[model samples]
Target: MDRGRMELYNLTLPVGEKHHTLAFLGFLAGDGAPAQAIELQARYISRLITGKVAPPTQKAIKHNLETIKNFSIVRKGKFTYKVPLLKLCDLIACEIGVYPWFWRVFLRDPVLAFMVWYGPIFTAQYRLLGPDSDWDRARAACYRAYDVISANGSQRDKVKVKRDDVTVARRRQVLLFTCGISAMFALGYLGKSRNLHGAIAQWY
Candidate 1:
């Protein structure tokens, strides 16, 4: 799963790959970060599921990331233009919640997962706007946010996805399955998949 994500980003092997995911996890674990506790619990669940495929020693090595015991904050220049994009990620993260790790190992509807994860974010947002709040409007506002992120971040252009690869390749089924998982995660986050599923569905 981690290697697939690294390839998706075209990151240099070994050290570069570890740095990227670790940096994301670091930010996620920061103090007052909404995802801190969930990340910890998810990491535990992830190790349990991976136990089916990995030996105990390997699993221990993989799961043995440093526990975050101290918290700090550093104020920096803000990019106002990206604020909407940030909100879009927050919405999707809230909608997906911690279940993607489990979902990757189980059969479940991604749509249902959204509702199951919706209670908290919706309540908080609903309170901010009181009775006048509108769900559709909020959805509309974030509609292009994903597009913007995907457009800028995707490595699809770099991969040589031939016509035959889509139609006649031996790996067609795997590609399609990956694309399906990618689509599901597009409704969520590519990083959520515990397998080789990518964020961009058109990678093949």
Candidate 2:
């Protein structure tokens, strides 16, 4: 395959499925509207696919269009988009679950590992709860992380297990407080301890 198709294959479905291409196309279609105008170049899309651009720039959008053109995946004429015959093969490859082999090799990078693991958690925490939110929100963020762990269904199972254990520990503390054990210590021991010697002197 050509470089642009290879890049799209590598970026969206580095693993075993081409679902992300549909996601990309859906993004382009924009809620039943025609695709947005391209404002950026192919290099920008390359940056986006590689994770260099977090939200992707207009330049990146243009780059995606150009890449599709270069790969003959789509033809452009009279300012419109058209799909061709070989493009059907590309779609089929996506549908049948073929991914580039390089992802397995590149998984060794630590930064990529962190992104695959904790990136969504951090992103959600910052967006939904903000960095300065209280511990309750922070803990909820961790719970979101736990959900991601559960959904992925991989060796990351340990992450959810650990979060579950922590949640249980917090629940136990809440139970103790509800039973008045914490309040009892404060009212009984602490209150009496402060006045014990004074009360003894009064008795004398």
TM-score per model over all chains: 0.21, 0.19
What lDDT tens digits, residue by residue, belong to model 2 across residues 73-148?
3244422233342332233222222211122312323222233344332322222221223434544555666667
CA lDDT, every model vs. true structure: 0.32, 0.37
The most accurate candidate by TM-score is 1
Candidate 2 wrong stretches, greater than 4 Å: 1-61, 67-139, 151-204
RMSD list, candidates in order: 18.4, 21.6
Model 1 residue 93 lDDT score: 32
Could you give candidate 1's per-residue lDDT for residues 26-68 as a string of tens digits?
A: 2231223344233333343344345522322433333222111
lDDT measured at residue 157 in model 2 versus the true structure, 0 to 100: 41
Clashing pairs in 1: none
Superposition error at 186 for model 1 (Å): 24
